[model samples]
Target: MDNVSQITMFFLSGLNETNNHRFTLFFLTLLCYCVTLLVNISVIVTIIMDKNLHEPMYILLCTICMNGLYGTTGFYPKFLWDLLSPVHVISYSGCLVQALVMYSFACAELSILSVMAYDRYVAICRPLEYHSVMSKQRLIMLVCFSWITPFCINASNIFLTSRLKLCSQYLGRFFCVNWIIVKLACFPAQTTVNGIVADITVVIYTFHGIFIVLSYMYLIKTCANSIENRAKFMQTCVPHLTSLLTFLLTGLFSVLIMRFGSKDFPLTFKNFVSVECFVIPPLMNPLIYGFKLTRIRNRILVVLTFKTK
Candidate 1:
C-alpha cells in the first residue's frame, strides 16, 4: 500500500448511518439553510437600509448577523451536497480550508461578542461617555479585530496541521476539523507544536469569555442602583446575554464533543452535537436581536408591510 502521505482525499464516515434517509435529510437541511439565509439577510438588510438604525448597538447587531451568515456559509452548502452524494469525500486542500473557515467563524463570534459586551458596558455603566468610548472609528477597529484576529489564529493552526504527514484519510466526522486532522498525524511527536498553539488559542478565547463575565458583573451592579438603569438593562443587556449564552453553550458543547465524545455514541447524536453551534446561533441570533430591539422590530415590520402592499 502507498504511504498515507500520498493520500489526497478524506472519507467522511459520519454519514454512513443515514444513507436510507438521505433524501429526507437533504430536504430538511436545505430548508434550514434557506431559513438561515433569509433571517440573517433580512436583519442585515434592515440595518443597512434604515439610516436611523445606524448607532453602535445596531451596527454591532449587524456585525453579529453578518458573522452568522459568514460562518454558516462555510458549512451548509458543502453539507447539503454531502447529504445527497454517496461518497462523502473532500480533497486535502478543501479539508484544510473548511477547517480554517469553521474554526475562525467560531472564534470570531466570541471576539465580536466580547466587543459587544464592552459596547454595552460603556453604554450603560458610563452613559455620559458612551458615544466617545464607542466612537465610529473605534467600532470599526473592534470589528476588524474580531474578524481578522480569528482568521489569522485559525489560519496559523491550519498551517501547522498542513505541515504534518498523515497516517489516515478517514475522518470520522461529517466535516473536516483541525483537531481531527491533527489526530491523523503519522507520528504522535509531530503534534506537540500544534497542541501548544491550540492551547494558546484556547487561552486567548477563554480570557474573552472571562472579560464578558466581568463586564456583565459590573453592568449588573451598576443597573441595580436605579430603575431607569434596570429598564435599560432589561431592554439592551438581555439580548446580548441571550446571544452570549447561546453562542457559548453551543460552542462549548461542540468543543467538548470534539475533545471527549465517545465513539460508542450514536452517529446521529454526535452529528447533532457537532452542528448545534452552527445551527442554533445563526438561526436564533438575528431573531433574538430583531424582536428584542424595538427599533429593529418596528423597521422590520414596516419593511414587511411595505413589501406585502
Candidate 2:
C-alpha cells in the first residue's frame, strides 16, 4: 500500500451505535460530565478557599480532582459530538492529540494515587512526622512529577509514531488508545513493545508496587497501634483498600490490553475496563473520601449548598 493509502482518518466506532442510542448516550454522558465537573470543582474550590481543608490531605485530594477533570474532558467530548452530529470521523492530528490526552491523564492519575497511598501510610504509620514528611514543598514536588511524567512519555510516543508507515486502516476499538494506533501502523513494533514494557515497569513494577507494599505495611502497623480503637482505624482503611483495589485492577487491565490483548477483547471485558479508567476513578475517589471522612462529606455538602445558593 502507498503511504497515502496506508494512512486514513479514524472514526470512533461507538459502543452503542444506533441513532436513538446515540441521543440517549449523549444526554447520559452530558449529565455525567456536568455532575463530575460540579462535584470536583466544588471540592477543589472548597479545599482552596476554606482554611479548614488547607491541610496536606485535602491538597492531595485537589490534585486527584484535577486528574479526574482532565480525564473526563479527554474522554467524553468526542462521543458527545458523534451523538449530536452522526459524523464521527477523527482526523489524524486529532487522534494523535487524543493519545496525548489519554497518556497525560492516565500517568497523572497513577502517580497521584501512589502519592495518596504514601500519604495515608505516613498518616497511619508515622503520624508524628506526617506534616514534616509531606510538607508543602514536598507535596508540590510530588504533584509536579505527576504532571510531568505523563507528558514526557506522551511526547516520546507521538514523536516516534509520526515517522512510522501505516498499513492497517482499521484499528479495531471504540476510541483512540495508543496501542490500537500502533496496531494499525505498518511499522516494525519491537521498539513500541519495549516502550510499552518500560512504561509499565516504571509505573507498576517500580512505583505502584512500592505503594501497595507500603500501604499494607502501614495497615499492619495501624492495626497494631490502634488497639483500643482498632475498629475505627480498620473502618477508616476500608475505603482506601477499596479505592486501591479498583484503581489498580482497572489500570492493570488497561496496560494488559495495550501489551498483550487483541482488539476483539474490546467487544468483551476490555471495553468495560477501559471505560472504568475514566468513569470509575473520578467518581470513586470523591465518594470514598466523602463516605469515610465526615469532614469532606460535610465540606462537599457545604460546597453544594453554596452552589445552589
Candidate 3:
C-alpha cells in the first residue's frame, strides 16, 4: 500500500478535475486538437503539393509538423478516453508504449529544432556554404539522427521502467510523461531525479544554448553589417523568437514555482506549464509561420480559394 511492491493500477486526475472544468477542458482540448491537426496537415500538404517549397526550411517544417502530429494525438486520446470512461485505466504495456512514442516525438521535435537552428546557422552564418553543408544527403542524415536517436533513448527508458513493479494506485501520470511513469515503476536507481535533471540540462544546452547563441550571433552580425540583411533576418528570426519567448516564459514560471514557491504552487504551475508545452507549441507554430511567412500565406490563400471547378 506504500510506494513499492507489485502495483497495477494508477490514477491520473489532470483533465478530469471538475464537471464544469472537465466539460470546458474537453471542448478546449478538442478544439486545440482539431486546430493542431488542421494546421499541421495544411503545412504538410502545402509542402507536398507545391514544388516551390521543396526546400530545406520547409522540409524541416514538415518534420516538425509530424512531431506535433504525434504529440497532440498522444495527449488527447487518453483525455478523450477518460472523458467517456470513468475508469481511465491503462494497462502496463499500454503505458510503456505510450510513454515511448510520446518521448520519441518529444525528443525528435527538440532535435528538429536544433537541426533547424543549425540549418539557420549555416544559412546565415555561412551563406556560401549553406548549400554544401545541408545538401540533400546531409539533410537525410540529420533527419535520420533526429528520429533514430530519440527513439532508442526513450525506448530503453521505457523498457527499463517496464521491468519494475509498481502499485496500481498511481495509474500513470495525467499525461504520458516518460519520467513520471518511469518513477511510478519504482525502479531502483542511484539518482533517478538527478538523471532526469542531467538529461534535461544536456538537452537544453544542446538545442537551446547552442542555437540561441549561434542564431543571435549570426543575427547580430547580420544586423550590424547591412540594411539589406534586415528583411530576411526579420522573416526567419520571428518564428524563433516567438517560440523562444513562449518556451522561456513557460519554463521560467515552472522553474520559479519549483524553486521559490511552496509545494502547492509548484504543482499547480507545473501542471499548467505541462499543458502549455503540449497544447501551445502545436498551436503557436502554425500561427507564427502562417501569418508571418509570405510564401505560406500565399500558398494558403491559393489553396483556400481553389475549387477545381
lDDT of each: 0.91, 0.71, 0.68
Candidate 1: tens digits of C-alpha lDDT, residues 132-249? 9999999999999999999999999999888888989999889888988999998989799999999999999999999999999999999999999999999999999999999999
Distance (Å) between predicted and true CA of 82, model 2? 1.4
Best by TM-score: 1
Pairs of residues at least 3 apart in sequence or in different chains that clash in candidate 3: 7-166, 7-167, 8-168, 9-168, 10-170, 10-171, 11-170, 11-171
Query: If scored against the real structure, what TM-score would every candidate get?
Result: 0.97, 0.84, 0.85
Task: Supply the global lDDT for candidate 1.
Answer: 0.91
Cα-based lDDT at residue 210, candidate 3: 61
Q: Please, what are the lDDT tens digits per residue for candidate 2 over residues 1-309?
A: 243224558766545435666678678889988888877786787778889888877788888888888888878787677678755678777787877787777777777777777777777777889889999999999888877877787767766565567766554455677756666666555346536744663655356657666777667776786674366456555666676677777777776765676866545355545667777777777667766777787877876788899
Poorest 10 consecutive residues by lDDT, candidate 2? 1-10
TM-score of 3: 0.85
Give the per-residue Cα lDDT of candidate 2 at 307: 82
Cα lDDT tens digits for candidate 3, 3-41 = 333555556655344445666767877887888889989
Per model, state how many residue pairs clash.
Answer: 0, 0, 8
CA displacement after TM-score superposition, residue 194 of candidate 1 (Å): 0.5
In model 2, what are the clashing residue pairs, if there are any?
none
